[model samples]
Target: MLHCPRKTARTLVYSGIFLATGLAQAFALDPTGDWRVADGVANIRVAECNGSMWGAVAWEKQPGGRDTHNPDVSKQNRPTLGMPILIDMRKKPGVDQWEGQVYNAKDGQFYSSTIKPLSPDQMEIQGCVLGFLCGGETWTRVAGPIPSSPANSMAKGPPKSPGAPPHTAGMTAPKTTGSVGPKTPGQKLATAAHPADPVGDICLLPDIAGFAH
Candidate 1:
């Protein structure tokens, strides 16, 4: 059988493209886990939300800290311990990075954020203000099984540590008595619910239906 040179070249090119795409998809990183941030001062739980990923502060050193610097006067009094800071993070196609917005509780500013997994246990998080000036930190994964239910996960407050008197401005300190363990599948939901402000109209990606909490 006679073979054309052009046909052989086209077959090689197609094969290369297929392999590249396959590798990208195979190695795609999932950022759904617990991450320690702010030099271990806080722990945030990242989970699936509306086809994307959203993270909320699951634990903090100072559980009574309020959003004192928030731009909105009404929200300034809200507790920062359980606030959602990582919103609507979607994996960029054919890449190892996720793009989203990160809300800084200290300054109450939202910045363009990118998350890249350096390894299974570590991630590099970068937030930029003007697409030029940027700052970032390496976040380490928290070792534990995340709570099974949304209510169990979101409602549980951080364990208290021995420290100075609790800051008593806007919120009271979370009770330090309960065990912060993973809840069973059929665990009864708490009667008093923790408030999760809706992220409606704040998500950069409109296709996402917004987070429930």
Candidate 2:
């Protein structure tokens, strides 16, 4: 048997702990769930679709709002209820943040944006207009912490991290997960009178489907 020094053993232990801490910081935060926006007018539901993240309006204080400001005339008449606000957010390696485009319905423009989960219940959102950085806003969690699925249904919900946001409303990414089981009859069936599950429904929404992958 070889002799091992006590001091060397202790040093090794400390090194292991430090490495573990660093690795934890490197992985992205799971930003899934319903999150109340800074203005408190609506909640955005966020979830993972394919491989990236997407967020859309889930609830609004004043229903029947329209995306009348959309630059695309054909889309202007669309309702804002389930409209995607955070478009195509992907994880930023080595940090707990996601980078993408955020829609400003007020102006019908998309801005460069980044979302960071400050804590389990809070998130920070910052966007830029024509490369000029704008002010950031904080969002509070409201729902979700659900799961991410191929369809983003509860059946395929993603695993929740003690992180993420700007969601539970729309930036709550990863939205909330487990090994998805076989599909059930209740999964995708929908009609105008009874809509599909909003959490994962955005995955199939026409507005973003063309670009979801």
Candidate 3:
């Protein structure tokens, strides 16, 4: 028969408790949900994409509800809609952080970015094009499912203008699981709409570079 000391048993119990506490904290800090980021300059909403950890901005509210600066948009006199913004984010080892690219749709520029979630409902995003000239923004959690296939519709509608702003709504991501399911056409389409890029394995908006500046 094997025997264990009382002190060893106590140590094992404490270790197990510590591990559980850490896991709970991690779950609480996971920033996996719909979020809204708006400054006086712009208002944008994004949701997690299906099959990938990346979230895409599906809605953009033009600042002031009018394009007073650009004549092209002024001529149309319409709000910016359907703008794709955020890229896919992959978790980094040993930290509660995600790193990915952030493309400026208006200028077709890509920046190195990092998202460190402060809480389940808050995250600090730091983006930099030239490394030193970095800008940071904080995003607040929004009430919507994370972007996914069910949320994004494939019903072909009226022809959208070539210059139509990127989308910022219409889908949410799903929780990661090990269960494998048969793929369908809708799933294939979703994968096409938000293709995985070379920079990361996470799914993100394929056309996020075209967002209005």
Ranking by lDDT: 2, 1, 3
Ten-residue region with minimum lDDT total, candidate 1 = 197-206
Residue 151 in model 1: lDDT: 24
What TM-score does candidate 3 reach? 0.49
Q: What is the lDDT of residue 27 in candidate 2?
A: 35
- Runs in model 3 with CA error above 4 Å? 1-20, 38-52, 61-80, 105-108, 144-213
Whole-model lDDT values for every prediction: 0.58, 0.67, 0.48
Q: Ten residues in a row with the worst lDDT in model 3?
A: 173-182
Candidate 3 lDDT, 1-213, residue by residue in tens: 656799789999999999999887775564554456746343234433332244444334442232233334532343334333456656688987777777565555667888877875677888987688998989875432222333233312232222112233563322221111123454354346546312121232334322211
Candidates in order, TM-scores: namely 0.57, 0.66, 0.49
Candidate 2 C-alpha lDDT tens digits along 1-213: 775699789999999999998766543345766678999998887766666777888778888999999989999898998899999888898777899999999999999999988876688989998779687899987554435443334332344332221223433233222222222232222123235334345555555555764
Clashing pairs in 1: none
Residue 129 in candidate 1, Cα distance off native in Å: 0.7
